[model samples]
Target chain A: MFFVKNIRIGFRRHPLFENLSFAELKPGTMATIIGPNGAGKSTLLRTIAGLHPMLSAAGSANKSGKAHPEQPPIITLGEIAIENLSLQQRVKHIGFVPQVLPQASSLSPYEVIFSSIKSVQPDLNREEADQRIEPVFRKLEMDSLAFEPMHTLSGGQRQIVSVAQILVRRPQLLLLDEPTSALDLRWQLKVFEALQDQVKSTGAVCLMVMHDLNLALRVSDYLIALSAGHLLAEGAPVEVITPAIIRQIYGVIGRIETCSQGRPWVIADETV
Target chain B: MLNPPAKQIAGTSTLTNRHQQVVARRVLCVTSLVVAMLFIFLLDLATGASNISFSQVLSGLLNSSELTTPEAVIIWELRLPYSVTALLVGLALGLAGAEMQTALNNPLASPFTLGLSSAATLGASLALAFNWNDIALTTHLIVPLFAFAFAAGATALILFLARVFDARTGTIILFGISLTFGFNAMVALVQYLSDADTVQQIVFWGMGSLARTSWEKIAIIFMVLVICVPASIIQVWRQTMLRCGEEHAKAAGVDVDRLRRTLMLRVSLLSAIAICFVGEIGFIGLVGPHIGRLLVGEDHRFYLPASALSGAVLMLLASLASKTLVAGAILPVGMVTALVGVPLFVLLIFTYARRQP
Candidate 1:
């Protein structure tokens, strides 16, 4: 199980989160972070990814890189502190899909898919890596786009390739930011389905920041809500995504309805 | 959740076959470039002023017994060294160019553009101006040591500016231009202060000649290449990772700053090796990797070697042009390359732009 404790993150010389503590993020499940703009959603994801410099106990940031375990900004992924792990060590367990796909990469999708594997698993032969990625490409139905250059692919196709980049690695902790933002409905469903299968089958912890509340509700196992960098709510979808909380955090009058699939989805009616 | 049954993952049979074919094609492309480079090397050796017959050149190579012959002396003392030096320097600059561009995250980054070689030239000019053999250091090592120190200093300055200003690729490139101008001024100032022979020697050094290299210098270049080429190829995975994006590479367990710093040092050393012996050869570092990319996309596996080979090819061809452009009279190889490379550089820019989605 991976757990984050007492994370206080913010921008340069300004505070966003002050001594923010949360419970453990268990394996074999998915959690979505939902908040409005400037709500520290992306910042939080970046902090967890060890990109941001964490605020100290005095509610200030002196250094802006990885956080130490003795401090408040530690993420415990298994036995080791996530911040202390080397990149080579980190990639073995953590696969991160950034919100923005890297631009101007002229590599073919086939090269993109295998690039990380070459670095992360140096022992895996070319044929072995192909065997590992074959099933993922087949499942994603991106087999036809495999040889095409990355710049030639559509945004949605690039997003799928990004997801495939992570999935082929099969990390124990998968962190994504708005992975489906560029995708259409059918591809979104397929992407989420693939993620769901990957999480359940491997007992990995999948965390993502999402704007689509309905899709978030249908797919995620746990929920974490924030507004203006403060924790608004966190629990099962039924308890946390109530209309009252939606009005407080999002400034919208929302309704929670039980769909035919028995999933709790949010439908925003009007501004409060 | 909705989808078809897993017909795609049915068996691993089809994926490997296709993957092997793709890998083979890339290998074939790189292999062909190497062949082309050797062909150019041979063509370069044959077409020079001595009018050594093709049969004599062939016999000189195939028959080791003819080592003392006039043909062997021409090949050994003059043509072979020049051609080998051209090939080696081209390969070094090409590799350095590819690594620098990726590390700096700037398409325009190269030894010449970034003033790296200029910095070295500035240092070499100072050494030449002072006639600094009186220093306690070994006589032969002093010039290169001085050049390397200045080049490293320039790199340090650029990296420091980048960190301080939170500069991205554009800002760093601007700093590179400033360094280039500053170093060129320094070199020019030193030339003005020197006596006539010193000035002439410095000016000739600045023209970038493979013809001046001795076997000793050739061996030094060879040693640097043998050490550097494999050293870089070992980091192909890192280079590929960095190409995708810095943050993305960081997330995958790469220390981006550390990687950049290490590459800066390596590129500094490689460019120092190039300019210390030869002088400020421009444009190859900018255009070489672009040619490599045009031939073999961005796969560092093939891209790096392809770039080095193309670098060698361009140098050989430029050497040929320098020999032929004014008949028996020698034109500066640097001038010839600049004339050839500027147009090729423009073509690559358009090609890169057109390929963008």
Candidate 2:
């Protein structure tokens, strides 16, 4: 289990959010953060990834308060505090897929996947790295592009390779920001399924920020909706995707219905 | 969850063979560059002050027993040292260029383009203007010391600006151009204020000739190369990672900022040492890595050696052109490099543009 509590993030001299706390997130499940354009979703994900500096806890906050106000803004993964871990140690447990798709690199998919492990485990030989990467590629059905240059691949193909790169590392927490921004419909489904399978097989936790509301409702086990840097709601998809929350967060007159899987499926009707 | 897709279809044989083929091709590409450099080295030795025939050149090189002969004296003392200096300068510049591009994540970064050479020249002028050798250890060391300090200072200034400006490549180049122009004006100012003999000395040094080349000079450059090249190859992983982009490399556990800083300093050191002896030769550093990237791609394992060889070959050819350009007057090697480098640069642009579409 992991907990994000009392987290405060912002740039120099301005605070974006304070007293941000979330309930414990468990392994073998995924949570999606949904918000409008300036809602600080990406900033929160980057904060969790340690890419942004977070402010210290205030003096009056309580340690054990599960409600929003009492605890310090701290991320504890199991027994270890994330901020206290060394960079290499943090990378061993967390895999991050940033919002931007990197420009075409000269490295082949094989090398790109190999680089993560090789950077940490210098003792791994070429044959050993291949042995580790082959299974992840096979699971994703991306073996054809294994030896091809990453620059030569299409956008969807590179996206799949990026996902495979993360899966191969087997990190305990996977934090993704707009992981499927470049993917087509079919590849988007494929990537979400891969993430689900990885979480299932490895018992890892996934936290994602996505713009697509329907996709978030379809894939996420839990949802956290943000509006103007404040947590509007956090619960199961059915609880968080009500018409009132949709209008409040997205400024959309919307409708929601229970799908066959007993989850809320939402579609915007009109701008309020 | 969706079905996990088919298990596996690739053959182990095909995988192993394909991997071996890539290794073989990289080996072949680097070997060809080495062979080409060797050919140019020999060709360079053949044409000089006294025309030594191909047979005489061969005897002088292979059969050193004929040490007192005229051909041997010309070949051993004059042509060989000059050619070696050209080769070393080219190698250093090319390696430095490749590293600068990789570190800065900008293709336009090179000793010439980024005003590193101009800064070196300015530093050398400072040494000459003040007679820094009196306080410094030796004359030979003082010039390089001042050049390296100035070049490093320029690099640090550029990097600092890059951080402030978010590192738009065009902005960085503009900063470099300003530095180049500023340093060039400073160098000219020093010339204007100095006496005629010192001005003559400075002007002659700026011409970038190989006449100052000696066995000792070649050894000094060789020793610098020995120190610089291995220092680079040791960080081969960092070089390759930086090519993937700085933030991405940093997320993957490489310290991208620190890597760029170290590489910038090392490349400046190489460029400073190179220009301190032979003055400023342009374009080899800019174009050599470009040619290597075209031939071997961006994998630093092959790219580094290929760029170094490409540089040596270009310098050797320029040295020959400097000799053959005029009947008796040896043209400045700098002019010959720009003559060769500009067209090649234009061709590279065309190739890159064509590839984009």
Candidate 3:
């Protein structure tokens, strides 16, 4: 369980989020954050992950401006701070998939995955790390690409490997930034399936920044809509995937239709 | 194990194992390459003027010399320590270059690029100008120490400037160039102040040579190398984390700044020791690590040792080349390194730039 309460964050001379507050993340749930570029969606996630530099308000008039409301401690994975944590500590609990996948110089898929685990379990021998990572590789169907240089992998394959690297650590909090952005139709489905399986088995709280509204609808249990760094809506996917919310948050005219299966999907009209 | 046979072969598990094997083999290749480089260094030191055959040189090296004459003195007392000093300095330069490149995440980073050589030159020049020799140790001890201190100070200043100037790699290099000029001006001022003989000596030293090396000085160089080399080696894995980028390293819970500081100080110290005794040996650091990276594929765990050995080989070959290049007068070994390093570096730059995305 994790809670991100009243976490106001901004960049220098630029306001990203102001007095933004949210609370209580339950285990075995996927919360998809959707927003436009430069809306500070990524910045907000980075702030929560404690990866980005801490941005305090610039001479705010309100007394309660900077304080965070008490809630369950959530693991934050901002790209900047992510690089500062020891490999051991990172692997122990937090699994972060950055937006721009990192290039693994000459490291095999196994070395890359093993490093993630090694960060948490430095005492784990190579054999032990391998044993721990094997299942994750299997879940992602990356067995064929395990020995291949990460450089040789196609975009989707590399993304899968990156996901496996994070998943292998069995982190309590899985923070992924556009993990499936590069995946194709079948692979995207498989990736979501893998995430669902992981959530079911580990009860890990997953918070991901997703661009695809349809994919989020299919994969996420909860939805958090953001517009210009402000929270637009937060609720179950069924309650939150409304055309009004999409218009308000994304500034797009959209229609949400519930198929016969009761799964709501939002379709944005380009001509409108 | 009723697994699909294709799955068994093509599975993530097997691929992961294969990557592990690749890493192992890469490490093995790096180690063997290092050994071969060492042999080349031995040959370089051995095959000089008044050539003592390999057997005699080896026996002299092992202290079982029967040729107790001029040849023995020339081999044991003269060429041996000088060759060892060149090797040590080369090794330091390569390690320093690799560390600087990794820390700054810039391929252009080298001892010369960072202005460490100019700093040492400035320090040594200052010592020459003011006669830090007045403090009275043997010329061998005091001169080297003075140069080392100045170089260290210069290194400190450059690192400080890097932080002050916002730590951009390009900015640091530009600042280093400025510092190099500033140090050069200072050296010039020292020369201007010094009498003719003192200026001559300083200028000659600036040209760079391992000719003046002796066993005592080599011992000091050895101690300095011993301290930094293994310390650097121990941090090799962490250095690899850096190749992924500072953000990645930090997220993995590496104290990026701390790693930079440790590596910077160690590299500067080693490099200062190197040039302090050898008077600014050329281009070994600049070229050595790049060559190592090509061989070992940018993994510092292997790259560091590979660079060190490659550097040693480069210097040794340069030393041997200096001897053969002229009939009687051996060219300054620094000149040889530059002549060799420039063309190789051009090739590296062209190839590296072409391969970039």
Candidate 4:
């Protein structure tokens, strides 16, 4: 299990969070970060994923009431301050699927997947990279798009392909920032299902920032709600995704009904 | 999820394997092109100037009987060095351009764009205005060396600033262009100061030519080219990673500072060696890699070498065309390269850019 401590983070002069505290996220457990727009939910996820560097805990007040180092072993996904690590080393354990799909020139999807492992062993006298990447493409259902240039891919297809690249690396910490935001409803479920399977097979901890409350409630084992860059609540989804917490974090009037699966079903009250 | 898509497909239909096959085929084709280009190079050498027959040229080259005296002298003494020099310069410029494009993550990036050529021009102009060497030595040796040193110095300076300030690729590129124009203005100033005789010599050298080539100059090109080529090959992976950006490259385990410094040094060195002796032979260094990319795609492993071949071939063809343009009069190699390179490059940029968006 990877642990992050005394995590204070921000960019420029403005601090996003002052001494934030979270438990060691482990395999078989998924953390759903929920917050209103501009609430630093993505910032927290990026920090834990090691994309952004940690700020000093001494400078900011913390609800957790603790202080720790400025550096941690977190691998961030999108818009993280990852100036310390190298690409090859980062790919080994930290697979980042940035929010914006990279507009790579002339690189085919197969070549894109192959590049993730080029550092492990360059295709020196052996073309083992292609053999290895085939299964990954098949698993992500991107075999049809494999020959197409990455730039030509549709939004959902590109998202899947990005996730596929990370999955091929089999990173220990999979940090995804709204990976399913742009995906269609079908692809949204499909992408999360793939993530669930990957977590089961590889036992990697997935820290995701998801916008859909119902989806988050279903997929997440634990919930960390933030309001204005401050942690509002942390607990199991049934305890945390409550009407009071939703009103506080999202300012929405919503009913917390139990779904058939015994998870909280957040049905917003339009009359609010 | 989605039934995982039919487990697996047959061998022939899979794109992963097909991509590998395509990469392999492109490599083979590039290798063949290099071989064919070399054959043409040898043929050009044997037939030029004196119009020696293929048989006579072959016999002379093989050290056989019935080989005429003039044929051997032309092949060995004059045409041979000139051909090899053109080839080596082409190789240097082509590979350097490929590396620059990848390093800066801009397709327009080349030694020329980075102002190396202009700086070299300024250096050569300075040397000419002052008559740095008393003897009226061939422009082949003196002109290039001066250009090389100044170009490398300019490159080193830009890299240093980039490192210290942590500037983006765009910033660095703009700085390079500004420096080029600045140097060009200085060259103009030096031209104004020099006498008519000195100005004529400087102008001719700046025009770029293969007319004054000798073995000694060819040896320098050979050594520098040999060193630059393999170094570029070894760094192709790093170069490709750099194309992803510095942060990405750093995260990939590359020491960003070292990679940047090394690439800057190599590009400057190769560029200096390429045009220093040749004066300012324009587009081989700029458009060579671009044409190679269109033919071989963007995998640096193939693109780099293919560019080297294309550069050499284009240079040799341009030089030959310049030679045969008018029986008694010849054109500057730069004039021919600019004539061919500008229109072709403009077409490519528009076509490629349209496909991107």
TM agreement with the true structure for every prediction:
0.88, 0.86, 0.85, 0.85
Cα lDDT tens digits for candidate 1, A32-126: 98888788888887777766665665423454444344665567887779866666777888888888876557687778778878888888887
**What proportion of the true contacts does each candidate reproduce?**
0.64, 0.28, 0.35, 0.31
Find the candidate with the highest TM-score and give its number.
Answer: 1
- Which one wins by TM-score: 2 or 4? 2
Error of 2 at A93 (Å): 2.0
> In model 3, what is chain B's TM-score?
0.87
| Ranking of predictions according to lDDT | 1, 2, 3, 4
lDDT of 3 by residue, B154-211 (tens): 7788788767765766677788788888888888888988899789878887877878
> Across residues A1-272, which tens digit of lDDT does each residue of candidate 2 receive?
88887687766455667668888888887999999997788888777776666665543234434444545457888777996666656777788777766558767676667766677566788777777777787677776666666777887787777677778878889988888998989878988998999998888899999988899988999999988757889989778888999899878999997778886678788998
Q: Which TM-score values does chain B get in all models?
A: 0.85, 0.84, 0.87, 0.87
Across all models, the iRMS values in order are 5.4, 5.9, 5.3, 5.8
Tens digits of per-residue lDDT for model 4 on B1-357?
A: 122242355444565556767788888969886896787687667646466787676777778456566666777887777778778888888888887887777888888888888899888887777675645563544666677778887888898888889887789899899999999999889989889988898788788887667788778878877777778777666666555445444434455567666777787888787688778888787789888887777767788888888888778777676767767566777778767667767887798776554
Window of ten residues with lowest summed lDDT in model 2 chain A: A58-67
What is the TM-score ranking, best to worst? 1, 2, 4, 3
Write model 1 residue lDDT over B127-203, tens digit each, in one string: 77877656434224666667777887888888788778877767777888989999989999998899998888677
Stretches > 4 Å off in candidate 3: A11-20, A53-91, A104-108, A138-158, A259-262, A270-272, B1-13, B69-72, B129-143, B184-203, B341-357
Error of 1 at A169 (Å): 0.8
What class would a CAPRI assessor give candidate 1's docking?
acceptable
DockQ of 4: 0.27
Candidate No. with top DockQ: 1
